[model samples]
Target: MVGRFTRGLRVVDDSVDVFRDNPRLAILPLLSLLSIGGAFAIVLGTALRYGAVSSVLTSDLLQYAAIFVAIAVSSSVGTFFNAAVVHCAFQYFDGKETSVRGGLAAAWQVRRKIALWSVTAATLGTVLYIIDENFGALGSLARVLFDLAWGLLTFFVIPVLVLEDTKGLRPLLQESGTAFRETWGESITASLGISFVFFPVGVIGLSVLGWAYLFASGVPALLIGSAGFIVLVAAMVAAQVLGMVARTALYRYAVADEKVGPCAGRNPETIFPSD
Candidate 1:
């Protein structure tokens, strides 16, 4: 294994290069659209069946339980698939030809690790939700704290799993720590940038849909609503794909810059070392 301290510092410095060379960010939204459709279908179906739409705030025990289960499973599959796509992007950046099929295959190959990571994240989120629901005193602060901690710790989990080809809880945690310490600021910025770009698109799309719904009636309203929903789903998937592309490029840049470790004789770096 590489020196943890050195890898940490390098990751931080190289993350800028990753951001600068973020060509892959442009395509992420499209990929996200595809993935979100499948994931949200299950979620929406469960919600409708449980009457979750009528009163999400006042959902019964069974309704809440069903929603939680649906969310957890959907999130797990989405996370795994997204991570695999990121891995494929990394391979492409490294000059190894790759395809979505290859990426999906890689994702399935690491199913266990991805599932574990997804479950851990989902559990944490669920716990925070429960706490906030039951304890008004905790408020948003608790949720914020939980998210921050989780985000920082697992920022590099996907990268580590993809590049290092390592699996299991210990490796994920260790690699994530090293990657974060090395490139925390860049990682956070890249993440925020992706979110910033998507949030506006989502808001605008929903706003337009809302206005359209007011003017239309019956089937027309339903048609408009369905179209709006499709657009929203597409936008979400695109965002995810773009995010993966950016993240993959960034990680590759970091690795090539020797911020993570020795260049590993990959790509253009194999011919010339990064300064």
Candidate 2:
């Protein structure tokens, strides 16, 4: 387990090379964040203008529908931009020049598939949310376990949908699961390693803000807190971008069996040394 964690950490660290090569990859997630945030703002504004929230809350069916719509929209937008990120990362691996426009174009080419997959994801997510809210402690545990399993299964689905010629959502999920199973250990460990690295930085940023709040006041505290918040957000965004790059790298190495560009010169054992 220790060995696998180390290998995964290396993969996460090496992903920095891809980020440096195409710093603009970070822009994809920024676009996603803006798109989703804008969408939610519009929804909230419309709901407030029409008093839709109270009506929706009055009926369980309406409440679930509202949740479904929110999840569906957010999932669709997030998945679309994630597809773009995977597309760009694949191009980078192939040693071809890539741009944000090119990545967006690639994702556009598979818009229908992405949409279908997003709806499926949203449906399951909504069901889980309902279960979590309605059931007691057992429901919460089930939701957590199911969510973890779903995440692992769908880890490679975006890449598959964007890069492969899979026909339908079922096939997409199947392919993603197959790919994940093939590279299960290293891929999962890499994801965990990313969380391990970023979680502390976020906590430290909050800790600094807490200290400032206790020791300083007025403009100084505000400045310190503001700066810390900005830094924390930047770190979070960078972490998301690095995760996509690392996923692409791992997919290329484990699934595609091609070790080019950022993956070159590293043995497969480097990522799966225990194997």
Candidate 3:
């Protein structure tokens, strides 16, 4: 676990440098977040129309169905945006100017793949969520373990969907899982390293923002504090974008066995150690 954590940190460090080197790439994730928010708002608003949220929450079938559908639609939108991010990241990695238009266009070109992958991801996500909502002590453990397993297997699915010459879902998923198993530590460490980097930053930012919000009793001060919240949220989005790039770097290394992101002059093999 310690070694895996170290691997994850290396990915994290490299990701930070990549984002710093290509600050413009942050625009892709920012746009993705806006798209996701808009898409989810529409989907969720439609779902809420089925019945009152209180009623939906209480009825087992209605609640589960509502939540599942909402999750699936939201996940699909997220997957779509993520594929766009992958395209932009790869383009930037290869020494090209990344464009939002081209990224979205490429994502549209492969919409079917995004939808199929979203089905798999959303199903797993909804099931794990349901497991937590419905079960007891055992269910919590199951949810955690299931999430961990799913994370490992699908970590590179978006990148594969974008970069690999594969044509079908079966091969994409199978190849991603195989690669993940062979380079498990890198994936975990990447996740761990990202969390490690973000946890404190998030806490500190939110804490400071919260204090500012508390002290701002006047309307103008309150507006300033609200803007601070927006900054905090934007920072969080940047952190997420950083993680996605880091994950993509690891995927590139795992698949191509080459220098990537922050690890650019170093030995690529060290980044994807099996043991």
Over 4 Å off, model 3: 1-10, 42-51, 208-216, 220-224, 271-274
lDDT of 1 by residue, 1-275 (tens): 12333333343334334434544443433454455566678767887898777776466565456556655776676677677667766765566766666776777777777778767766766777777777786756888887888777876677776667676788788877776665554555555655665677787778768966888888888888777776666557656665566566556555555322112333323222222
Q: Which has the better lDDT: candidate 1, or candidate 3? A: 3
Largest TM-score belongs to which candidate? 2
Candidate structures ordered by lDDT, highest first: 2, 3, 1
How would you order the candidates by TM-score, starting with the best? Answer: 2, 3, 1
Model 1's alpha-carbon lDDT is 0.61
- Clash count list over all predictions: 15, 0, 2
Stretches of model 1 off by over 4 angstroms after superposition:
1-64, 218-231, 254-275
Over 4 Å off, model 2: 205-222, 273-275
TM-score per prediction, in order, is: 0.69, 0.89, 0.84
Residue 57, candidate 2: alpha-carbon lDDT: 81
* Span of ten consecutive residues with least summed lDDT in model 2: 266-275
lDDT tens readout by residue for model 3, 1-275: 67666767776777777677767666666776777778778766876787467777678877767666766776777667777777877887888887778878878888888877777766777787778878987889999998877777777887888777787778987989977875676666667777877777677767767877677678766776677667666677667777678767767777777656755776645755656
TM-score-better candidate, 1 vs 2? 2
> Which 10 consecutive residues of model 3 have the lowest summed lDDT?
266-275
